[model samples]
Target: MSVSSVSVDLYSEKQLQQLVEEISLRFFDKPFRHRAFFNRRLRTTGGRYHLQSHDIDFNPKVLEKHGMEELIGVVKHELCHYHLHLEKRGYQHKDRDFKELLKQTGGSRYVQPLTERKVSYHYYQCQDCGGMIRRQRRVNVSRYVCGSCRGRLVQVTKND
Candidate 1:
């Protein structure tokens, strides 16, 4: 999928629930009556549906990295759990109803890992002379120097 910059209006909690309801209607002939929201603190998992609260929490990283389509699939996956549990059908990953709903709805079997997401970098520079310095690992200015002028390379603040 194509990558896009972070967007704030991606989906509201109400809009997400509506999306889930629409997907359920389109594919499963059911309605999704639950809460859905973006959970920015979610790290590795794409989405989670709570049985007790009947709320779906999504990973914001999915929108940041994989964009809209991937986010939709994640919502569908959570809807699988939401609908099945409410209907008194099997609602867990290993249950028959859950698996069947997931397959029929074309939902992702599991949330993708966040490791593929883009990461910001920390950059350092030399102040004494005009030079470029880059390091994933921070460099100690006391030991590092600009080779041309034999001038010390002061550690400039990082970009990230």
Candidate 2:
């Protein structure tokens, strides 16, 4: 189902909870008894299922970037984990039960990687050759020199 046909904001925490419950019933023939909510802090993953609390957390970006269909897919993926865990079955991603249930429920095997990683690079420029370098670790300009020309290096910019 497309969000375009629905007037309400589908990514709201309450709406997510209702959607999860509905999907759980429809696909798994089981009720989702735990809470479901959007978690802005989820960066690389589309959703998370907490074993201790039986709660599900979804990444809002799934709805924003891929729309309701993808969000529903993620919900189904988490539900696979949720139900399997509650039933004392194999719930880990690498387990046979997880793979089988995920396939049976039409859940995504893996969430698409985020378009961008949350990484920052320190950039430097060679004074002599004008060559540039990018590194995850900050370089000491006084100690490190350009490899090509052995020229002094200067900080350029920090890129996100």
Candidate 3:
């Protein structure tokens, strides 16, 4: 079978919920009362913790591509958000408490790319610092200047 058509059905929805509950109790010393299930719609993020319903949705691609270890790390990360938010602590990523708890729990800070999407970039060079900048969309060189050294930017031709 082609790699693109390959699929992984490692766990059922009920099993996913059980796993989340187990991880939450083990790592956070709390219970996961809400639902946890696979979300096929998730694209870039490994998992998402909802604020309204208190549910956690996981991207199956994490297990499919990276395996169980990475999936556990992602579960820990989501549990960090779930528990902290429920306790009315700093649950957001920018908060210090979230960072500390994430560190303590050994949660993943970033997930590997789930799928490859081809994006064409416009390359630019700074005249002063000689630094290169890559942008997915065409940048307005006339209006925008280099973030560092405040230098004029010139577009560079690159065939990707």
Model 1, span 1-160: residue lDDT tens: 1123324356676666666667777777877666678788888889888878998888878877777778878878888888888889999889988988788878888666777566655455566676777666777778877766767776566555
lDDT for 117 (candidate 2): 66
Model 3: lDDT of residue 45: 97
Question: Cα deviation in Å at residue 139, candidate 2?
Answer: 8.4
Each prediction's whole-model lDDT (CA): 0.75, 0.86, 0.89
lDDT of 1 at 62: 83
Give the clashing residue pairs of candidate 3, or none: none
Position 153, candidate 1: lDDT: 74
lDDT of 2 by residue, 1-160 (tens): 3323543354566767778888999899999998999888999899999999999999988888777777878988999999999999999998999999999988997777766767788999999999999998999999999999999999997555
Candidate 2 vs candidate 3: the TM-score winner is: 3
TM-score of each: 0.62, 0.70, 0.72
Candidate achieving the largest TM-score? 3
Pitting candidate 1 against candidate 3, the one with the higher TM-score is 3
Clashing pairs in 1: none
The number of residue pairs in model 2 that clash at the backbone is: 0
Stretches > 4 Å off in candidate 1: 1-9, 116-160
Give the lDDT of residue 75 in candidate 2. 88
lDDT of 3: 0.89
